[model samples]
Target: MAYRKDNLRTVKQAYTEKRARALGIARARLAELHRTIPELCEIDSALAETGMKLVNAITAGAEGITERVAAIRAENEELQEARAATLRFYGYSADYTDVHYECEDCKDTGYVGTAMCACMKRALSLLSLESAGLAPLARTQRFDTFSLDYYQGDDRLTMQANLEIAKRYAASFTPASESLLFLGKTGLGKTHLSTSIAVEVIDKGYDVVYASAPTLFLSLEAQKFGRDSDIHIEEAEDADLLILDDLGTENPSPLHVNFLYRLVNTRMVSGKATIINTNLTVRELRERYTDRVASRLLGEYLVLGFVGKDVRMQKIGT
Candidate 1:
């Protein structure tokens, strides 16, 4: 499996510590065994000697030495039984060698039979979450904190419809899911709905990349200007789900505009899921960006219009 430097460092450090702990446990167990029954080790040495004798006898002459070899083999078997009994007295299984590995196949490398190891994939996924800055998002917004009570009864039907759509969209998200475009005025729960979806998908173990348009675009611009465009593309292209919050908030340069188009197009063509929460209306989006951009979005995106009074304004008693 191909791993980035950071991922590799994390995995290698974790695996090394795990292996060390296992070895330490194995050593302590063996030390207890040797203290409790010192004769077992002696028997093991004699058994090894007898094994060599059997091999040497088989190589020399297979005729008269058969009886001697048989007697030695019988004695070795008896010693093995005695050793096993000693180990049983110490409460260790016969197969408890000095290697307490979690997986004997790849020894917890999480790979076997030419495929990514399940454990390794889980590690990579966790590292991806750390890389994507999801921890802060989870702490800031929570679904349980969402109050449908804030929705307006004047547009009760529209508000209920939007809530149900958000619920269903979050509930039914898959890797092959179509993109989403959340359109409405500011503070109408657009950010809340998208962040809620991000939480759900993240809980299901997908790597969700959640960042505002300004934050993401600034980072992309920095990478491009600093000669690190490849890093920008890799992150944008490879995330399982991309949540671009407040799309019209960023200062649009020609480089950023083209970058945004190519980023969205590349992800769409590759069938990766994207969720864009924008306060801009359709007409505004077309004017601010381009018709081609708006057209592609309208064509492929599952648009959900957030409906309600501005919750922020209500909180401020405006």
Candidate 2:
């Protein structure tokens, strides 16, 4: 799985800090033990010298090398025993001075040789989820957690199909994947499925950006007015998959309409995937977003219409 550059940097920094902290703690413990037990210090010093002796013996010559290495190993084993006994005699654990890593498999390095450790993958997934604005829904709104019980008859079949399509799209997502348009009323599982896709895509190591229509437009406006930086807009344009939720809910404005056109057109030209969730019907969308924006969306997007009662109300028996 590939992670975004920034996310990778963040994980690497965390690993560096973890490794340093573990080593630091171990050093502190060793210093404390040295101060308390001078005999332990002598034993550790002798054990440390064995490493150099072994290296020197190997480089010296092949003749008598095996015997020299054997002798060194015997001495090292004796010193290690002495050190452990000294620690135990002082009521300390034998491994008290050892660096205790959070993940011993990788020694908290976040990697095993050239491959990434599971710990690092999990860290990247969580960071991506948070950065994509899907952390809140990630726990309960995954594809597997989506319940077809809320839907009935044809609605259930349609939703099941949609779910399968979403899973397939996420499984094979790339920068050039097809854009999606989720047309449905509120609380019809559009947002949930979109969130599910985001979670899966992010887990697959693709950069995803999720933003509500109102929030996205407001951020764009802020950037235009010099009140905010343009990073948000850049991310929206450059993400491997961008999900704009709750379209047509933002306050109507000509400037926002123009921004919408630019955003859609830019991502389309770049071949970046985008998912737009809206309560507006096709006719209403055309009326609201003008032909320019609607044309690109209609011509290019794979539109999925969601149909079902509000799952939230069903759960509350309302």
Candidate 3:
């Protein structure tokens, strides 16, 4: 599987250390067992001699190799039985000194043959997700954690409806899922619910990219206008759920505007899902961005309006 340099470095380093620790444990166990059991020393020598015999027989293409190999295996099995008995007599399990690896297929080396082990694949995905800066929200912002009690008056019911929509959107999210346009005043539950949906959409095995408008635009601009970057804007734009938080909050620039146009248009053309949370009303959006960009969003996205007193302000005395 393809991996980023940072991801490769981190995952490979961890797997290498795991292999080292596994070998270290096995060696220590064998040494202790060899010291305690005199019979084991003789059995070990005999086993080594039989292994060399098999190697020589194979190298010489010698006749009677099959019979000789069978005899050697028989001898090893007998010796293993004795070894197991010795451990059992000492009140230890048969596998007590056996090295335990997190992945039996790879023996914790992170690969079996030429393919990466499932353990390593899972680790890579999990590590990538964790390092993507969504771990904090994974704990706090979930559909279950969202409270309707935070709203009051008509704002309360509006937020309740918004919350349900967000939940359904998250539950059913896919690469071709309907894109949402979250328009509202600041401090409504827009950011909170959008972030919560992002966490769930990620859990559903989609690459969900979450970033503020400034960070998203500036980084892309830097990659384009300055040093060549390993971080690609395509990764974000092509994500399954691209949540652009706090839109229109970033400083205005032709480069930022152009990048935003490209980002939004590319996703739209590709049928990728995007959720944009902005304080700008529909009228304000048209004025802030170019008419073309505004029309694209207004035409393509499913608009969801959020209305409520600032939840943050309501929480001050509570």
Candidate 4:
């Protein structure tokens, strides 16, 4: 048996449970009606007999097989009408016997023919977000929770405008959209707004990876050195929305520097969506990383500057 990733496995398991529950409910309803309503049972039995007769007529080299099948079909239709009337009399809908699937397009199978259903895709997206370790933070740091009241004067107005732009960006995010750079000091809400955008993108059913710079670059370094060989993940490259949080916090090493350059260049060239949160200015970034990576990031990304007091500190004091 082929192994499935945790997210896909979770989606499959959920769909399986839903399918079983829906089918079980349907079967119980059918049994209840069959026992309580004798007319339904009789009509169903007669319909089954007619179906068998039609099949037999088709199998045998019998003449007027079409007429036999047509007559049987007409009788079956009348029986169906009687069945519907009986259910209605019992204060049940005509489709009470039918399984009420979670997703009508897939009938709870998680697929429409060979294609995956929209509901299944969303389930997988949520599972993927959980697996990315962003689910908990996403719940608390949504755009609705981000407030401009934390800032003052020019900073407050700028933050309000930035909030609108961030909302628009999240609302219409695509892999093809311009990359974003969240630039601000430590006390600012760079991480908050970045994470807010990430939550929205993930809910839109796109793959997203939100990681601190040290964690991200360290994962890359480990992958290079065979230390992280237990599971394969090239998250920054593959994610539809790659949110690299606190870019300046990572310890500098040859491995980290080279990988950062590659990650930035790869995302820029591939037109993949990326958001970088950093306390470092463009000048600082140019001095730290090579000018190529800095130029690409500055030239391509829509820069959003954040300014505010440390809300964490304020909340703590309260």
Candidate 5:
């Protein structure tokens, strides 16, 4: 619901393209019908002229004009019906000349009066599909691909713990939830868990932003330097869920520290849920961000500690 002007433009573009494609398909089918059944074309031509006749009859205002107009309108309806029937005879469904839009109420216009139509919601979902990098993430984790078979009995305890926590976190996700921090070493399935949560939260129809630390920080830096004021901050603050992966990977600077603090602080105050996965330990986090920032995270966040030998190495037989 809280979409940007550009996002609204995306919705409009999607709607326009969908409606145009439907109209194009109907036009093509009509043309095909014209080629196959020439009488259908004649009926369509008569239906087109009926409007002119109705207007002329009303202007002339002769007695019995109402009955005449009604008769002409009825004939026009019958012509449309006959044309549709001819198209059906040729294997197309009824309503051959109609646009076959997703939303009949708005005809893919995206809005009805002041309210958003169903087409707009579909457009937003479609836009998210195009913008979010979901395919690659999904390909990596087949639910069937996960196996306790490889887990090292007691050594496998780490992944087992994380798997349980991650599953519960995903299942219990609500809009009014606290932020999450997944702290662990490399190849500990932190990214996998967080990205999985991203997919789940999106399914629940929440706007979620999933980006690595470097990419997000760079975008924030660009927005800061550019004349456009605080675009990244607004996006971060307003998104229903923020999944910041690889938290310690970005180049640290005073600006970065300040920006992060402000971003975290604002999100915390607003009670927006954020999920941050970091390789930094509690001490390193304190060193990078000040004690206040680190302490607040420790106190407020639901920390899910990731443990285990690097799974990537095991996969590569290292």
Candidate 6:
């Protein structure tokens, strides 16, 4: 359950900016208060020195040290009371000088002690989704939002079973979880289900990478040729889960075929799960990608054949 290094760095930088912004605003407010009320300036200065005074009293180890510490505490409390009274006299809130953080649980630091805070986790999940290219679809293609109303009869029953399998797989996914191969025609919910799985796995804190087959192959080709590529093949191989959508849509080329085999084989060897969504059947897959790639897809991956009318078309018609 980890995020990519770059994504983590992005989130950490955001937290840094947030914390600095809060502190900066608080400092500016305090400066304004000090300028408007001379009495507040003195009170704040005295309050700041109280900490040093206590440190000195403890380190000095002189006689009557307890009495000195007690006196310091009493004086600090009195200063606070005076400060509050003075602020009220000036028609300002007593806490007007406090820094307001976005997430109080970790004070916008993105962590609580040595552990990552919930806010940070959520931030990482969202960033990961965006980086994985699933953010837009994830917003609407989650498991709960999938509709079986577009299916009917045997097709509906088969889709229902497929939906349950996808849900279970996502709920129990791990780095070493079995891979999946979604076979169906265009707009039959293959993309929707695969995206749903990716979203669920991402929300559970695992890094996921989602890319269409054509885009993935193009990026890989660019990288292979020393051109600028947004997505690295290494990221796809290293992700906890990879959702490769619209397979068999890429232009047929020996380079792409070899790259596909290598990518799938590498992830398989590394025990990472991958979900491949293709409109091609097992026979068509073999014909398109050759036996080497198709063998892995059939032998290693759990095949789910979707049966339904084009749900996207149904939606548009209705």
Cα RMSDs of all predictions?
7.0, 2.2, 5.8, 5.9, 6.2, 3.0
Given candidate 4, what's the lDDT at residue 34? 95
Residues 1-318, candidate 1: write the lDDT tens digits.
Answer: 224456657876887788788888888876776666778768778888998888887888757787878888898889878878877777778767558777676676666887756676667656755666655655556566677778857565776676677777778877678898999999888887777777777555576777788878777877767854313557666777888889998667777778778988999888889989999989988887788788888888988888778888887994
lDDT tens readout by residue for model 5, 180-221 = 899988887778877777666665556777677777778787
lDDT of 3 by residue, 1-318 (tens): 234356667888999999889888888988987898777778777768878877776776667878877877887788788778877887778887788888899998888899878788777756655755566666666678778887778877888888888888888777888888999988787777887887666555467677778777767877878756434577787677788889999766777777788888889889899989999878878787878778888898888888867778877967
Candidate 4 CA-lDDT value:
0.81
- TM-score leaderboard ranking: 2, 6, 3, 4, 5, 1
Summarize candidate 2's per-residue lDDT along 168-216 as a digit string, tens digits: 9988988799999999888899999999999988888889889989889
lDDT by residue (tens digit), candidate 6, 1-318: 577888899999999999999999999999999999999999999999999999999998889899999999999999999999999999988988999999999999999999999999999989999999988999999888899999999999999999999999999999899999999999999999999898889888898999899999889889988998767788898999998999998766988889899989999999999999999888888998999999989999999999889988999999
Q: Candidate 5: where is the Cα deviation over 4 Å?
A: 1-9, 42-123, 129-150, 227-231
**How good is model 3 by TM-score?**
0.72
Each prediction's TM-score against the native? 0.63, 0.92, 0.72, 0.71, 0.70, 0.88
lDDT of 4 by residue, 54-104 (tens): 888788777888887788788889989988898899999999999999889
| Clashing residue pairs for model 5 | none
lDDT of 2: 0.90
Candidate achieving higher lDDT, 3 or 4: 4
TM-score of 5: 0.70
How does each model score on lDDT?
0.76, 0.90, 0.78, 0.81, 0.75, 0.92
Off by over 4 Å in 4: 1-13, 24-106, 110-121, 229-233, 290-292
Total backbone clashes of model 4? 0
lDDT for predicted candidate 5 compared with the true structure? 0.75
Deviation (Å) of 274 in candidate 4:
1.3
Cα error, residue 149 of model 2, in Å, equals 1.9
